[model samples]
Target: MNLSIDVTNNEGVSNVVLTGEVDAFTAPKLKDTLLPLTKEKGQVVEVDFQDVNYMDSTGLGVFISALKSTKEHASTMRLVHMQDRVYRLFKITGLTEIINIESTVQGGM
Candidate 1:
């Protein structure tokens, strides 16, 4: 399963929607897609993972790196509409506490 990222600008925020498998072989693509967005100062970025079917540690690493980059630029990064499996992974790994994860679009931070 190939990973794909679609980026769009909404108001002043950047919405990055990710789909397909994000594993060792495909996590780099996700990272590359998000790197530039995080470089800009005060840019709000939200990564929607509602359509993502699978992910691994590499994928989680990519998300963490992106979050760090956003912080360095004084921008905010969030994860929205995560699937149950993905949400569980975040919980077990303590990532849910470190990064904001929304259960639904209406509940985003």
Candidate 2:
């Protein structure tokens, strides 16, 4: 399926829900949606990957860039509700150590 991104801002946080595959083509769209949010100071960006089926290296790059942008702005970015397959990708890549992942809805990143 093609990638789809849904964004919502509430209580100083930007919640991004991603559906479908994230590859080189779709990563750019994710980046564009996240870049401006990350630039906002004190804004917490939560990426929900519950609906995502697959992601490639370019997708990973988008998250990394968002993380960096958040840090630079004194904001934060988090991954939420990742599927096991996608979670494994980050774990194997050592991104789990650097990025916050919330496995449960109540789990704080």
Candidate 3:
């Protein structure tokens, strides 16, 4: 499947809305679009994963890299509105503890 990433920046925050899958084939695209935003000092990079229903380890790598970059640049990365199935990957991989993840669903965080 293909991956589509839409990014907008405002008030020192970069909002990324992702659509489609993030597997091996699409991870590079995500990395390209997200990592650059993390380079800005004290910036906030918020990614909406509500429309993304599928992802693999490669996608995790992209986020991990972005996280590391954010730390180096003093930026913040937030992943929000993720589907349960995709969120489980982060949970099982122990990333939920390190990454800031939130959901719009009631009782979710």
Q: What is the TM-score of each candidate against the true structure?
A: 0.90, 0.91, 0.95
Question: Which candidate has the highest lDDT of all?
Answer: 3
lDDT of 3 by residue, 11-64 (tens): 999999999999999999899899999999999999999999999999999999
CA lDDT of each candidate? 0.86, 0.88, 0.93
User: What root-mean-square deviation over C-alphas does model 3 reach?
Assistant: 2.0
Question: Mind sharing the TM-score for model 3?
Answer: 0.95
The residue pairs that clash in candidate 2, if any, are: none
Between candidates 1 and 2, the lDDT winner: 2
Off by over 4 Å in 1: 104-109
* Ranking 1 against 3 by lDDT, winner: 3
Per-residue lDDT for 8 in model 3?
94
Quote model 2's TM-score: 0.91
Better of 2 and 3 by lDDT: 3
Report the C-alpha lDDT of model 2 over 58-104, residue by residue, as the tens digit: 88999899888888999998999887778888889999999999654
lDDT of 3 at 75: 95
